[model samples]
Target chain A: MRLLYQILWKDHSRVHLLGAFLGTLAGFVLLLAGIQFYMDLKAVLSENRDLLDPEYIVINKKVNIGNTLGLTGGGFSEEEIAEIKAQPFADQVAAFNSNKFPVQAYTEGEQVPNFITDLFFEAIPDEFIDVKSEDWKWDPEKGTIPVIIPQDYLNLYNFGFAPSQGLPQIPKGVLSMINFKLRLQGQGRGNYDDYNGRIVGFSNRVSSILVPLDFLEWANEKYGYFEKNDPSQIILVSKDPTDPSIIRFLEERNYDTIREKLKSSRMNIILKFVLSFLVLVAAIIIGLAFLVFLLSLQLMISRSSEKIRRLNKLGFHYREISRPYILLLFLLMAGITGLSLLLTSILAGQLHQTAEAWSLDISSSLHGVIYGTALGLILLITASNVAAILISTKKLCK
Target chain B: MLEQDTSGSEVWEAESLLLEQGKPYVVEAPSGRGKTSLLSVIYGIRTDYQGLVYLDDRDLSSFSSKEWSKIRKNKLSFIFQGLELFDELTAMENIQLKNRITAYHSDERIMEMARLLGIDPFLQRKAGILSFGQQQRVAIIRALCQPFNFLLADECFSHMDRENSLTAYKLIREECEAREAGLILTSLNETGLPNIDHSLKL
Candidate 1:
């Protein structure tokens, strides 16, 4: 490093200082950007890291129960369920069902959705509400648990039952939206004539619709028309996706794979793209900076040609004369790289700390520092060439 | 035929001539006569020309560029016609730079030469800040530290007064003899260089 400094700066002290400062600054900018981009990706990744884990099997099949169609479809068989339970990777299978929590409440003066006639909300089952439980201890007296949902669901769904047009309005907690299609022949919004509505639970964008056993049973009988009860979706949780043995074990079985909720290898590709883009941007910034730095170096070299020639006259070799310059540029890069790392590290670190202090609920990430340093080094190496050695043939002749 | 040992030639030809070891060889030549080129050739900087140039009984062409540098850097020194001092460094720093390139430690040789060449007073000042004469004096000090066997002086004494030039010449000759090294000095006018035993006229 010292040798590099000598070569690059031996003849011109100011240039050495200036070039190094600029290089380090460039490095810093590159590093900061790289780290930032990495953190952002990491947040995205860490959130889904569990999803990418080898153990989780996301049962994703789209069941669109829109304005008219009622989803009365049944789920997996008893034998199939038993087979999944037998798999070693299957820790605990929680049966979670997903249907869009219908915002079919009476918007004043508008016809409500027909699917709301027998509002068959795919409520979270007793199994799903007690999903975290090891044994799913049931309270016989309480008769299954109601689900917990975010508060935002109430704003989107309002069951308007004004008494002016209604017979007798049942208050909240008395009725639940069960599976019954509305035969709304009139255009103006009207209160429910058949179904009883109750907010058993609500849902955020994430899945959180739960109906206790009694409610589910009542709704199933009223809406599904199924004599025997059957689930809609069975959630499969795997043990290890990273483990090839487990993956093979699962694949060998007849367990149909659901790649929808499961994060795929495409996540890895996205991460690579983000990192590569940051590096490319950094390289461009640094390349331009180095070009400017190299210009100064050329002038210095042009001037030193005579001194070099004279030194040669005294028995100095071309290599010896060029050594100091080479050494200088090396040190220059090291110094700049060091400085850049320091500067960017502090800024990025502080930002990271601030993020932590503020308790931002961002997820963990997809990429790291390896990508950042790789980029900086490539740029510095290319730039040093411009600064290294360029002796005019005319100077040689002199 | 044995060449005539001129005192110190201010001019020289660009010919492959045998130079005696441990002798004060003066280069007398016009500006474009390639005195610096010959000097550079010996220094291993001029690589394109084809000829036999020997150093310490080894053919210059036989050694690799790296090997040549090792040999020359340790055993050589130059006095640029323009003095070629680093403008950023102080006068003393400029003189010591040659020594630095040669891996010599301390400013002892540089300071000693500075004292002898009458540039010691301006040693602390930068080369660009120094007068032309003062810069020349610093250049002489640098060459003195080079103690080079084959000093290729390219009119380093051009700006110096006759008295200083003579002193510079005397100092150079004394240093060359002490080191038992060769010298190939160039000048347009032969007013200063002294104690030369051989001359090459271009």
Candidate 2:
């Protein structure tokens, strides 16, 4: 006990105390950012709603970072889809067709020029119907279906229900959608009529409208490059890591697969490229935060570790050394995290109030702090540091 | 084992022979003839060198790590080489901390240790606020609280005057006698640890 204190105090008091505190600040924020980044992206791209979340299927190759969708082609061939469904890890497979809705409208007579591409929608597997968010329930009686949009769009227009006159009114029958929107347009504006089926539900909020793939396929035939075309779609793999997606199993471990299959070769590169790119960007951001965290951990270990060792040498148990430092770190990190959240809240509030569009609900949320935004400053200042301190403290003890 | 090398294989290796249970051994050596190393081994920190260290007639090597740690806590004590003392704690708190770790019944051992070393005067001051000499004494008092078969002092009295040295030496000897504990102290000069029960010089 005495020995641990001696060492901790020596380093803490003389040189590294301030550094430790600041490091905690850094660590907390970075870790928070990693989670937030994942979440923010997840909040955007995540599929599924009230049932199985729709999985995304990409090529079985290493996707490059910063690049998405190299080539467009035929959807997964029947054989490939069959193989995917056959795997133990497979949930279910369903073919889908998607097209951009660049222009959208509430009234049939006019269109909102800048409303831009609503995310491509698909006919999801029955399993994925409820797992994503708030599933859209089809109303066969009224022949009316729910429309889902990215929550970003809702936030943009004030929860999609703001009474202001300048923005077009959102149609009432739309279901919920996710909060983010991805723009994949190369040219020509698409309108809401692009979908074939009526929207009956939402995975989240209305960022984009989702309906069965039949609707989008019809629209693509009506508009996309090929004539009489039933557009091919990217295979969506919905397997959780703990429960590997069928595609993940087949993709990993140099397995026996359809060698050089046409669909696999082209779409393989494209899908793998897109998903991997997204995952990679997410990973790099997190990895950078982790690296900084690790370095800070090394510093922390160098500082307090010797002291802990000395304490252990003096017949002190692990708990004796660990308890005090843990308590100290908890207190310090709590303060930092609290202060950061507070600061972020204030900033988000002012941003919402002062900046017009960026203040959308997802950006400015409860107390004007969105999930990621609320924790951003703290994550920036503290999360990584907390991890760094913990890891370093643990390492030092060993 | 301070006569030449620390272990038996060295050219002039001198090993410590145990005195009767309540005696003091003064050891003298150069800055690094394993004085602290020998003390650590006795308390079981460096145990892999060629050694036959036995505690209560049992080889230390045979004990499990947990068992060794338990014996070290209950049966022995150490004054660290760097005079490692908690900077955040008061001098009195430093002594109290030692008692807290060994988990003996709460008593006035802290005050008792303080009074014995005359550290009671600086009891309320943080260790960081104390002078080196005072810290040294507090470190000594901290080591004095453990109920043990041996107290290992690592160059504890190198900076003290003869009178202060004599005071520390007398207190250590008296405490050893009272508890039937042995004293094994290291020094560049045999200023504090004295008398002739067992002597090893390198």
Task: Note the B-chain TM-score for every model.
Answer: 0.81, 0.83
lDDT of 1 by residue, B101-160 (tens): 665535676667677777778888878898888888877776666435666677777887
Model 2's alpha-carbon lDDT is: 0.54
* Model 2 residue A375 CA deviation in Å: 12
Which window of ten consecutive residues has the lowest lDDT sum in model 1 chain A?
A178-187
Docking class for model 1 is incorrect
Error of 2 at B70 (Å): 3.5
Q: Write the per-residue lDDT of candidate 1 for residues A1-398, one digit (tens) a residue.
A: 23223433555748554864586467556755576656654554455456544344544224446413655444555776676678676666755543222223222223333333222334444533423332233243534333434334443333343344554454334333332222212223552222223344443322444445555444344344334434555655554433333435445643334444334333544566777887777767766666655665566666566666655554455555566665556676667666665666566656666667776543233134633664556465645563356343123422
Residue-level lDDT of model 2, residues B30-59, one tens digit each, is 786677877876777775567476778777
Best lDDT among the predictions, by candidate number: 1
Candidate 1 segments exceeding 4 Å error:
A1-234, A238-398, B1-17, B24-40, B47-50, B80-82, B86-91, B100-138, B153-169, B183-202
lDDT of each: 0.55, 0.54
TM-score of predicted structure 2: 0.47
